[model samples]
Target: MEKNKQPKLINPAELFDPGPYGFSHSIAVESPSTMCFISGQSGGVGENHVLADDFKTQVQDALKNLHIVLQSHSMTFENIVKITLLIVDHNQEKLEIWAEEARNVWKSSFLPTSTLIPVSQLALPGMLFEIDAIAVKQLAN
Candidate 1:
């Protein structure tokens, strides 16, 4: 028996185009049993928070925090279907660095749908980047 063998759900092909310029190969869930919406995460480590002004460092910290949140629900990046990245200064170099980090974290098995947005500023004055994610747990029938 297959896990996602239910009938009444919207098909992925109808909801999203599989081949698009910026779209990934991830399938959007029709209806998920559990959904996790993570808040925008930054690179700050402490309670008072000393954020790294560097873009790569900020990306790293944000990914780390994302991992922690997913782990709490016994989930991993593989379960993540969508991710939105907000950057204060979006650049080719920063994107390259982020791609490298993403490869390390997500590995080859799963590549979640993603979106990157360049913003003028964030909530924090010195914050360079912020990342938020949406994950759904695929349960067996």
Candidate 2:
């Protein structure tokens, strides 16, 4: 009689449903090969670091900071699986405008799972928004 052989198991991240809200509940849940957690990235650095006081400039700077953190770990925006955004003032118009900027940066790639939280203010008085993210590197077979 020949012995029976078992197949190997494979696991990958999966997004959960968020019901009729039209958005997913969870982003991904898989045993990550490597996980990276980026700190909340703000628009400016030092007291005199304020570049562009406008919303568009702040958005651009935040994205640039995100890229810097990703680059430090040999990754890019495409590798990001989830993101959390904190906005100082919550408005549909502002969100729409910010979406445009985000689209310009992300391009045609699939948008990462995200959450936008409206807040009264940030740690810094002049700060308008802050963004944070989580990413995982898929292992090669």
Candidate 3:
């Protein structure tokens, strides 16, 4: 999948604002393809066994990790159908940073539906951000 692949973005006019706030109301996926689920990816630096301290960097690290998993199946960010974000030490500033990074990653194109969760802690100490995603790609005949 290309980073700019066309995926359905569902945000009804009647619904509350989502895009302006860095998320879509929902993402609709057309099936008949292989599905992939990535486990929660944190900001841990691979092979270094350490997590990034800053919120923005941590968010980017998680996305990079997610990209690695998606690429293994020939998919890209556009292949993502849904995402769940876990943020430790949740706050407006942290959310703003996360949203900004998300907008940067997707640009103005469609975005996968996302769920944000505020938590007191994560699977590992010092993990500030984590993300898990679901993706799908059409099977070649």
The Cα local distance difference test for each model comes to 0.71, 0.66, 0.74
lDDT of residue 96 for candidate 1: 94
User: How does model 2 fare in lDDT?
Assistant: 0.66
**Per-residue alpha-carbon lDDT of candidate 3 for residues 1-141, written as tens digits (9 for 90 to 100):** 544544555443433344454664334344457677666777766555467778888899888776766666667888888999999989999989998988877875779999999999986778899898888788777
- Which window of 10 residues has the lowest lDDT sum in candidate 1? 7-16
TM-score for each of the candidates: 0.74, 0.71, 0.74
lDDT for residue 66 in candidate 3, whole number 0-100 = 69
- Which of the numbered candidates is closest to the native, going by highest lDDT? 3
Question: By descending lDDT, how would the candidates be arranged?
Answer: 3, 1, 2
Give per-residue CA lDDT, model 1, range 111-139, as digits (tens).
98989999999977899988878888876
Clashing pairs in model 1, backbone N/Cα/C closer than 3 A? none
Off by over 4 Å in 1: 1-32
- lDDT of prediction 3: 0.74
Q: Write the per-residue lDDT of candidate 2 for residues 1-141, one digit (tens) a residue.
A: 123322211111121122343432113323424456666666764335464677667878878777766765566788787899998887987798679878886786777899999999886678887788887777565
lDDT of 3 at 137: 84
Looking at model 2, the pairs that clash are: none
Q: Can you list the residue pairs that collide in candidate 3?
A: none
